[model samples]
Target: MLLLTCPWCGPRDETEYHYGGQAHVAYPANPAELSDEEWAEYLFFRDNPKGPFAERWVHSTGCRRWFNVVRDTVTYEVLAVYGPHDPRPELAAGDPR
Candidate 1:
């Protein structure tokens, strides 16, 4: 089972959280000016990287707060956890921290 740490509640089972998809996705600056294609891209497109990726998760069963996590997609290893407003951490390649 995967283990995830909530920024507000500390470590807990992954089952207690809800995946919020790719992190740092900003909403379009001018929604009304965007074409259908652009709107669709903003809503659906996300990076699917092979290694460590920044993602959003909500601790539904605990604090019910949203946070970001740097996790390895292939190994299912969580590297870092931070609040939603915090900046994404810079992780070195091959570093297993």
Candidate 2:
């Protein structure tokens, strides 16, 4: 099974957490003025990048807190984890750290 480290609870089984999809998605500034296609895109569209990506996850069974993780989509490798409000960690070019 996959293991995901919670920012507050440390390392734990992936089952104790809930996937919250892509992180850092900005909400529309004026939803009322948006067209149907624009609103739909804002609500449902997401980039499915092939390599490493940032995502949000919640530690439901543990601390019940949400955090961000930089992970590789293909290998399921977690490169970093930080609180939702914390700035995303920087990594060297070509490095996952």
- Candidates' C-alpha lDDT: 0.89, 0.88
Clashes of each: 0, 0
RMSD for each model, in Å, please?
Answer: 2.1, 2.0
Structural similarity to truth (TM-score) of each candidate:
0.92, 0.90
Give the clashing residue pairs of candidate 2, or none. Answer: none
Predicted candidate 1 versus true structure: per-residue lDDT over 1-97, tens digit per residue: 8889777788899899999999999988889999999999999999999878999999998999999999889898898998898899877677644
What does candidate 2's lDDT look like per residue over 1-97, in tens digits? 7799897888999999999998988888988999999988888999898777899999999999999999888888898898898887885588543
Q: How accurate is candidate 1 locally (lDDT)?
A: 0.89
- What 10-residue stretch in candidate 1 is worst by lDDT? 88-97
What TM-score, to 2 decimals, does candidate 1 have?
Answer: 0.92
